[model samples]
Target: MFAVAADDCAPSDPTLTVQAYTVNPQTERVKMYWQKANGEAWGTLHALLADINSQGQVQMAMNGGIYDESYAPLGLYIENGQQKVALNLASGEGNFFIRPGGVFYVAGDKVGIVRLDAFKTSKEIQFAVQSGPLLMENGVINPRIHPNVASRKIRNGVGINKHDQRRCLLIHTGYDEERRVFAEPAGDKFL
Candidate 1:
């Protein structure tokens, strides 16, 4: 439950401090946390890819941001014996992976952790699991993708079922990396 909050635009504060913890080295996932100068409370802010050098130490950069977004990652700055961390997704830091059941706030253009396991399909709709069933950002839901299992097409001058058509496409596209997904029936492939 150790956490840290960070924002680049925040003014000087005497109380807040930034913290980081190792999550998974193989995945380069590191958890960042923040706390007050008076040691009252603390919480997690985000997880980022830890760039490590040959010495196996995190390459702490004064500049940080999301991988796909335009933003600057900020560290802790203490003030007024209280803590204030920026949660701006587009301007400060990168995307955050929130723990399931973890507390968070999502403003406009903000993305949060998504949990897919909680999704309940109605009337047996077909869908595929794209990612975690844990925490999700806003507008994210379960079954983001559908397992392409079959297709229909004319084969050998005979009309074939979707599944059969998929098999033919798979054979044709097996070696084609770019056309592999669309070349065959989508249902036949699974990630």
Candidate 2:
């Protein structure tokens, strides 16, 4: 991933360094995996790449959002239209437990970011991963996200363009020295 766009916010303003990776599932095979199809953890990206045959170069690879303390995906996970881990709705501490946690999914020729309850009846999903405290929903920022909050955690998030609603936008930001998950506003059009 690279800086697809830089913000126009002045130098004196609160800052964040951001990079975005855009995925078009139509021409790309976007799938989630924690292990091999045979049900063995591939252990490393290199080993997984070696085991599975793919066409063309891998454009991007990223942490599949917040996982459990053991590093397992903490919520719903779907790969290639197959349900792997069921959606988690339990409440507790940490980012994953944040109320209104949602999922980023790819289904048929579509991509979406959906809230927990709304995701229940979704069908034909090709790929999906759940993560907490949605950055934005219906163009409104999550009420819990305070740009001035003391949390200085650099976090990554997935979203779909509102206007076009086609591509999946993967964003990773520069570290927040405080080391906890938080959010910041990216520009209207990230170039």
lDDT of all the models against the reference?
A: 0.23, 0.62
lDDT score, candidate 1: 0.23
> Candidate 2, which segments miss by more than 4 Å at Cα?
1-16, 42-56, 121-123, 149-154, 177-184, 187-191
* Clashes (N, CA, C under 3 Å) per candidate: 35, 1
Task: State the lDDT of candidate 2 residue by residue for 108-190, as single tens digits.
Answer: 76777888988864567877888877776666667766555555566667777655677667765566532123233433432
Worst 10 residues of 1 by lDDT: 165-174
Best by lDDT: 2
TM-score, model 2 to reference: 0.74
Total clashes, candidate 1? 35
Mind giving the per-residue lDDT tens digits that candidate 1 earns over 15-101? 422211212222332223233345433322222222222343442222111112222223122122222333222222212332222
